[model samples]
Target: MMELGPKPRRRTPTVWVGPVPIGSDHPVVVQSMTNTDTADAEATAAQVIELARAGSEVVRITVNREEAAAAVPRIVERVRAAGYATPLVGDFHYNGHVLLTRYPECARALDKYRINPGNVGARQKDRNFAQIIEVALKYEKPVRIGVNWGSLDQDLLTELMDANARRPDPRSAREVLLEAMVESALRSARFAEELGMPHDRIILSAKVSEVQDLIAVYRTLAARCDYPLHLGLTEAGMGMKGIVASTAGLAVLLQEGIGDTIRISLTPTPGGDRAEEVRVAQQILQSLGLRTFLPQVSSCPGCGRTTSTFFQEMARDVQAYIQRRLPEWRRRYPGVETLKVAVMGCVVNGPGESRHADIGISLPGTFEEPTAPVFIDGEKYTTLRGDDIVPRFLQILEDYVARRFGRDGDGKRAAAPAGREAAAPTRRGEEDAGGVAAGSAARSEAGRPGRPAAGTPAGSAGGRAAGT
Candidate 1:
């Protein structure tokens, strides 16, 4: 990836969720919550591993009932036994104090405890909140005092509202509500500190669903607290709306350096992939130039000048190619995630954009040539044509990845020089740690998501029952 200038981060005290660090000094963390019933440890642990493999640095599961609490140890055990270091966070509400106390092993198994002050028992709110804090203190685990709009503490809102009502110039009800959300998190955090929880052991989040409200609430919270913050637009719906709303809301706060970690709350369809949330969160960070998790494909939306069918098909094929190769590529190529590949549909801006990417392919536009020009390091390496375009291009891509990012014979990683072509490198079979040859690897991958039409074509969990 080209250097997209990084924004100055907001400074905060660091909080660790297992081995991952959350603070301005650390890269913004990507996290996702599971929709699986926590009582089913096997299913939940499987999804946890899936989310972690998909790039969730931390995975949170709802621990709403005794069964769920009882399964915590097993879930943690399974996740660790599978060789994933991804931190597991237990989301608690209502009977959290009881669950944490009765199930000491569960409390100890979790990397962190998420407390929703809104539903921690209104009558015994402070007492119950203190109990969980004590458990966290005992286990030396971090706590996220996560506040959501739907679950803002009514007592705090009413208190703030009544106080505002008495003032000569009262604030709007919405303003008071947002204020209450912030207060709920901050007040709980302060009370936890008073109860012996270290200041650094606490994380704060005041989340609202609306993009504008989320921005306003977080801007205020960021100003008032020095604790690391978990950022998200709670209940961001499903599909395109969810993705856009989350990206919009998060991008703003992230650009301002407000969030320490992020989770995308997308309602997955039944039997849908829960790992989608993790991928989205990673993309948000990658898109903002804050972090790089996978190679990004830049493809133009087909215009009148482009052959819609062929062009669109190539774009989809290219993206699918990158995704399929990611697992192996990541293991073999240390910095391969920073690779940028562009699949342009036409000549107008295609070559220009292709030249800017680490590797790119400019497919001929309508009435142009029958060939696709492939670029590597800003130079035209070759022009691909015939039915072999996809395979050939993928071959070039894998070779570049192996040569530029893969380790050499001595096992030290090699890098392509900036602004110039690099010396001829050992072929993929020679240098690859896995010893997989470039030709065979590309052929296998291209065969899986093979492109048809030689010419052209086209192509989180959160919320109230528990804390997000």
Candidate 2:
């Protein structure tokens, strides 16, 4: 474990969710949950093993009741036994602390517990908070206080309704919803403090299904408090839309320095791996420069300028190839987070985009110089045509992965050398970890709903929700 400075006071992060530090200037975290039934030890352990291999910094699984809690120790042990120490977080809903207290073994097994602030019943709120805190305190595990508007406290909702009885505006509902989450979270943390827990022992969030609402509440909380925030778009759907929506919202908050950790929740597909959720989240954070993962791929969206379908196919093929061979990559490259490969559709933008990548291929049309341009370490090394693309591209990437990233056995940081900003990573939505100098400006240009494409893309932090 790397030794860090003595933890600070108020701004100090509550708990380190994983092995890595993830608060108060620490790199943003990327995490996901297991799709395997928590009750099924063999199936769940198998899923955890796969997730660990996929570069998931943290793995969460629902521990809805006692049966699920009983499975925690076995699953967690299986993860460690598999030789990967990916931090496990027990996702608890109602009566969570009861399970933790009854099965103290769970407290000893997992690294963190994600508690939904909105669901714990008011009548049992204090008891629930204390029970969970007791478990966390016993193990020194960090807690993520997650709040979703969809599952808001019934009592708080009623109180909010009563408070707005005189001049009720619909906006009041949103405001109350956001405020209620923050207030409930603060209340829970206060209990932790009263119970003698340290300040850096927790993370907080007010996640929502709506992007605007999620961004709004988080921004509000960050401005007022200093707790490390966990960002997510709860129940974010699947496919490109789910990934984009979650990224868009999270990117906005992350750029502004609001989120300490994040997850991109995708709808689980039948027979589909849920761990991919963590990978996609990692890619988003890495692309935005918030976290690191498998080498960053700067593949292009093919257009009329594209020479052949080869470039597009090459991109998919290389990714698949890497996926199949990750064990070897990790074994060989030691500390390489990703392979830093780029596959551009055309030479026009490809060449420039390829510069930041470790290995790159820029497909070209009939050219004066070469049929295709390939760059290694930013130098035009060779030209390949026709069927030569895939093999040559893979060769360059492998060389870059080996030389820059080193073999998997050697301990080295494959991340690019840091620049001036290591002094202080900017607040959310300002600059992504990608160091792309251009973020919201590019997003503004990408086009918004009714807004002009003449403007830049809406930031990942989120614009003013969908309304204002």
Candidate 3:
């Protein structure tokens, strides 16, 4: 049988961006770029903070002009003031060398510099590239040699095309293009190292718009060098189109374990939320089992057996409750982000599915009894009924989270509340009118696998119930 799961992450030298490190040794990093104007320090800083809170480990802002370059220090200062140490990367183009030289503070404030090798200038290409590398070396900051298909070096492409034409069995134009993208990234990386940047202080990216092209480019690029490649499908359109394209391309390579850091280049609609990109990047990583940033609610789509909308409303409320409580839970319950929940509307798969979650609620179907069974640790904990079902289930969820994940003031295990011991399993028709069945029992906290100890944060795979 074929082995399954994400390939072993490709080994590479680690590069520290402020306090965060990127390499095969660390978790795959999620990053985003602010669409806000970098010259507007207040707006940029606000968006950076939002992105960081939304789980962007690294945030980049364009530093194209003098004003933008001047604002870099203020932006970094404001973000730090907001209590976020999320590393900032300055995106530079043609004038990067001059701007970095003129605004020493900007260069010093930024955690990393991202320069497109194709746009550094035609005649002064080598000189400009070296200038940015020199500043990075001086400040001890890492550099990302980002190569985009739209901005690919024409000189290099022409050279490769001409060389390919001489071969007796030349590859297709698309094949040559992919090779050029990989070559541009690898060659620039080698040059940066020669210009004094250490191997661990450099990152590489070669992005293309189309899904297949991106996969082809990154696969070749990842094989040729171990510089911790940054992955993305550039110009991935807008709305669902962008999300689908980006996910398709990034997922394929990530499953093969080729990328170290990732960004979803989504084109948001006017007035759309800028933080959506951060969320999408997070979902991709989470879905691939690479990282966990929030509580995951597993819900089934409504079917004919579930005619009423009560289950629908319950699922939404449950998700909203988790979202609202996550901030407090993350601090108080070190491993709560890994919590798995199920909200099933019908009895067909409800109980079985609910039994598989850390905490779950299986609601009644049409013509079935109105009681909703709440399961904890694969056992029926209680039954909720009538108009009180939603609220009762939510309370049980809150109690379970606190009892299982909460820590004490002295950083010790928080004992279950008085009178909170596991009740004996309940029988039919035994539920009280107030909504909860008295005899149902919750799981005992002791000896539970994946229970987060006092001070340790939950591992990527912990905080979930067994058999899930």
lDDT of each: 0.78, 0.66, 0.79
Over 252-275, each residue of candidate 2 has an lDDT whose tens digit, in order, gives: 776666776677889977777676
TM-score against truth, every candidate: 0.86, 0.77, 0.87
Q: Which candidate is the best by TM-score?
A: 3
Residue by residue across 1-468, what tens digits does model 1's lDDT show? Answer: 674565588899767676556787667777889888999999999888777656667789999999999999999888777656567899998999999999999999998999999999879999999999989989989999999889888888889999999999999999999999988888898899889899989999888899999999999998898999999988999989999999999998888878988999999988898878877887888788877677789989888898557877877877877766765675577667788999999899999999999999999888887888888888887777777677667767766888888677342222322323222333332211211111110111122232212211101111100011
Error of 3 at 24 (Å): 0.6
Clashes of each: 12, 46, 0
Which tens-of-lDDT digit does each residue in 1-468 have in candidate 3? 897789999999877675556788767777889988899999999988777666677889999999999999999888777556667899999999999999999999998999899999878999999999999989989999999988889999999999999999999988988888889988999999888889999999999999999998888888888999899988888999999999999999999989998999999999998878878987898888887667889888989999999889889988887766665666567667778999999899999999999889999999999898888888887777667676667667777887777774342223322433232222332111111111111112244343323222222122211001
RMSD of 2: 13.3
In candidate 1, position 216 carries an lDDT of 95
Q: For model 1, what is the alpha-carbon lDDT of residue 338?
A: 80
